[model samples]
Target: MIDVVAAILKQGDKILIARRKEGKSLGGYWEFPGGKIEEGESPEKSLIRELKEEMMIDIKVTEPFGENIHDYGDKKIRLIAFWGEIDSGEIVLKDHDCIEWVFPKDLHQYNFSPADVSFVEQLMK
Candidate 1:
């Protein structure tokens, strides 16, 4: 299984969501900004590194909201989703095609990776 971490970052009533770049895996899908967890690294550390690499922002990871295991055709992904807050830096689309701060009700408008769909459901609840 591929271990990954995702940041559930919110600013008031809106949550941050990033659009994956075309030609990438799950291209055009929207997801919480995060990346693979390296060996010997904790989920929090992975989240911090991923946010910085993908979003160009630093964040402080809080408690995990939930975890989900999803299987795509080629691989299985084990996602550890955590709630986090921005510590510093600007929001730049370093890896994603675009970024949006969307309200929970509007989340369904975008296409999301199957694994990430569960996280969004948790956010709504």
Candidate 2:
């Protein structure tokens, strides 16, 4: 199973989301910034590494907001989500095509991965 971490970053009433690049799994879908956990790394460390690689920013990952598990065809993932705050640097899209700040209630407007949809639902509750 893939151990993944997602950052649920908020600025007041809005949260940051990113659109996956074309040709990637769940392409065109929007998701919170995160990636798979590397071997021997803690979830928080993995989140920090992913944010730096994908968003070019330093983030302070907080305690997990929640966790979700889902299967996508050939693979299953265990998602560990955290509420984070930006520490430095602007959000420069490096891996994703684009990024947006969205309200929690308005998250359903865009398409999300099956697993991510559940994560968002948990956030809304």
Deviation (Å) of 17 in candidate 2: 0.7
Q: Under the 3 Å rule for N, CA and C atoms, how many clashes does model 1 have?
A: 0
TM-score of each: 0.95, 0.95
Deviation from native of the Cα of residue 115 in model 2, angstroms: 0.9
Candidate 1 Cα deviation (angstroms), residue 65: 0.8
Evaluate model 1: give its lDDT. 0.89
Cα RMSD of all models vs. native, in order, equals 0.9, 0.9
Q: Please, what are the lDDT tens digits per residue for candidate 1 over residues 1-72?
A: 999999989888898999998888878999998999999999999999989888788998878888999989
List model 2 lDDT by residue over 38-114, tens digit each. Answer: 99999999999999998889999867888998988699999999999899999888778988888888888889877
